[model samples]
Target: MQFSANLGFLWKELSLPDAIRAAKAAGFHAVECHFPYDTPAAEVKAALEETGLKMLGLNTIPGDVAGGEFGLCALPGREVDARAAIDQAVAYAAEIGAGAIHVMAGKAKGVEAQKMFVSKLRYACKQAAPHGITILIEPLNTYDVPGYFMTTSDHAEQIIELVDEPNIKLMFDCYHMQLMQGDLSHAIERLLPKIGHIQFASVPDRGAPDHGEVNYAHIFKVIEGLGYKAPVGAEYKPTGSTEETLDWLKDYL
Candidate 1:
């Protein structure tokens, strides 16, 4: 149960290089990001080299560069755009030595839209395989992303099985799962084999680990018992400063 930090919200506070160092200082083994495509790969790679930190994962197809709401892969009818997005992610992952690409199944419209979305994901997964990167399909809750296509672990699992590829897997986000469905332990137990990545945040509020409803210590223990070796992503907004919020993880670290 190694830990990783998300750099999406930290960019305002730290430079890419400094963020990596800060994450290490705060006791994280790796760092994750939403979109690093805007930054030069050489520069990002240099930062990772200097910090001696690993790139846990990054989103391959983020939506609006400015609004940060849309991702290419689940745009219902934009398969071409989705492929291009996957290509960009593959290039960046190869350059940064990242192991996984977080695939967002954008807003869902209807059954037909979801079908199209799944097809697009399958194509994206195939495109990502040659780059030696695994794709992590995350299920966002309706409370945060109202119409997001992939909104449950079971939904993601269905797509993973349909794709039938070893490189494609689900990103079990504890916060989202807890919000959409309450059986966190059972969901994890059943999906452990197909999960390639995991993320955590307190439920109801998306705050730091100990501030909300989810029992992270027990969740971590369950994950450990299952023998998962991947880094667990800390994708939450601190109620205060990042440092102040991390106190909750002291016992585990």
Candidate 2:
């Protein structure tokens, strides 16, 4: 029942290095992030060294976020930018000793978009494989991200199969799955082999897991039963201070 604090949401107010320290002090076995590119990789590595916490993974930068583009890898005519983003993420992850990267698929649809996504993911896998980093594709819920290229577990699985790279894997986020699809326990069991990492947050409201409609206690038990030894990512927005929201950690365990 080990956990990884998702610095993107848990320690939103701190600098990335300080956030790493905070996660260590809070008893997280490891840490993961959405974006850590802003901080120098040397600084982040030093912090991880000081805290003795493994950096599980980080996401590729979403291109032109201010222009309403959540990601670029799936968008046609953006291969150059998308590959640049992947290169940046892989380099950063290598520098900080992270084991995986979540390659985001922007808002897009239709045949070309899917083709573009598969092509870019192949490139990403090629770039990451030598470094021993896994390429993760996550399915964002359409409710939270309208028209997002990926929205279902089945779709993600198909994309992974299409990519046909051993390094490619799924980033299964429980909150998004609960919104777009239910039957969490069964889905986990079915998708266990392809899953590289697992993340969770409260459903609908996207808050602490303690008050969620999803019974994380049962979910945690299921994960344990499945022999998932990797740290389960705590990717939730705090209902209050991050520290205050940790009662669920002890309760679930």
Candidate 3:
């Protein structure tokens, strides 16, 4: 039951390279991030090499964040922007030796959005295939990201099927799925085949896993029993300093 620190939430105060070192020092087996575009890939690669930590994955740039755009891939008339973001993410992931890229399907709905999402994902997969990088699509809970295009595991599965790309898979995030719908044990079993990566955070408040309604210990057992060998992503927000909230690590370690 190895763990990957999600630097996007774990070490907000440090640079990405420093965060990678911090994750290593904290004993995380690997590291991941939400966005690492601002940092030079060489520096990130150097840090990963120095720490000997695999970069599990990273997300595409959220389009127009200040204007409230969570993603662009599903938005109508944004094909150019969507594709550009995909290219950028894939290129960065390739340079940093990341295993996957989460192509965000921003706020949208209807058949057109689905069509757009599928098209963009197919494009993303094509670009990433050459680099052996997997494309991940996560179903974000609407409570935290209202109006998000992908909000249910079923919906994400449908999109994955539609894309029909072997390299594309679901980012089965436990926190969002539990918020949208409970039944974690069954969900993991049912979706295991399509899951490329799994992430966990305490439910209800999106904090450290120790206080969550979800019993991650049991969940981890279920996942391991199901033959998942990838390091599970620890993508929770710490309630205090990142180190202070690491008490939960003792249980998992």
Candidate 4:
């Protein structure tokens, strides 16, 4: 089982290039980020090349964060905006050679909302496919982002089915799953095929996985047993300094 440091959370103290190098130094097989739009894509690409590590994935731009747009994919009357975001993400992913892009659905619900989400996701999948990039839809727990559209693995699956796009897949985040519900092992087993990538953090508190309520060691074993070859995303916040907390990765390394 390989691992990717989520630079969005893991190495905030460093610039994009330095963060990529730090992740490589820490023995991560690959790296992922939330957003790289602010940093020049060429610079990030250079870092990835220098470190010889793959950039597994990144998130689509969250529209108007201050205006309460965590994601625009599921919002009503935002078709043009949503498509623009998708195009931007695709361009950025291509520039950096990222394999996947997580399309955020923001806080939306109900029948109309679901319909809009399906439409936006379909468009995203179609746009991303030609770039050879996979489109991921994650289910965020209410505890973290109340009213977020995708809140459970089943919810994500339902959306994926409705969208009916080959490029569409789930970004199965263990921290949110543990918060929204339990049964992580069974969920992973059943939803393995739909999952594009997986992320984890401490349950009840988004901290390092080592002290989490979830048994990561056993979970890692199950993932391996289930035959998932993709790198697991370490998308956790450090309880202390990020460097000092890496003792947990000694076994992984």
Q: lDDT of each prediction vs. the true structure?
A: 0.81, 0.94, 0.94, 0.90
Pairs with steric clashes in candidate 4: none
Off by over 4 Å in 4: none
Each candidate's number of clashing pairs is 2, 0, 0, 0
Which prediction has more favorable lDDT, 1 or 4?
4
Better of 1 and 4 by TM-score: 4
Please write out the lDDT profile of model 2 over residues 48-141, one tens digit for every residue. 9999999999999988888889998999999899999999999999999999999999999999999999999999999999999999999999
TM-score of 4: 0.97
Could you give candidate 4's per-residue lDDT for residues 62-156 as a string of tens digits? Answer: 88888877998888888888888888999999999999999888888898789888988888888888889999999988877988888988888
Clashes of 3: 0
Measured with C-alpha atoms, the lDDT of residue 155 in candidate 3 is: 92
TM-score attained by model 2:
0.98
TM match of model 1 to true structure: 0.93
Order the candidates by lDDT, highest first — what do you get? 3, 2, 4, 1
RMSD of 1: 1.9
| lDDT score, candidate 3, position 189 | 99
Candidates in descending TM-score order? 3, 2, 4, 1
User: Which 10-residue window of candidate 1 scores lowest in summed lDDT?
Assistant: 61-70
lDDT of 3 by residue, 1-253 (tens): 8899999999989999999999999989999999999999999999999999999999999999889999999999999999999999999999999999999999999999999999999999999999999999999998889999999999998999899999999999999999998999999999999999999999999998888699988999999999899999999988778999888787766
TM-score of 3: 0.99
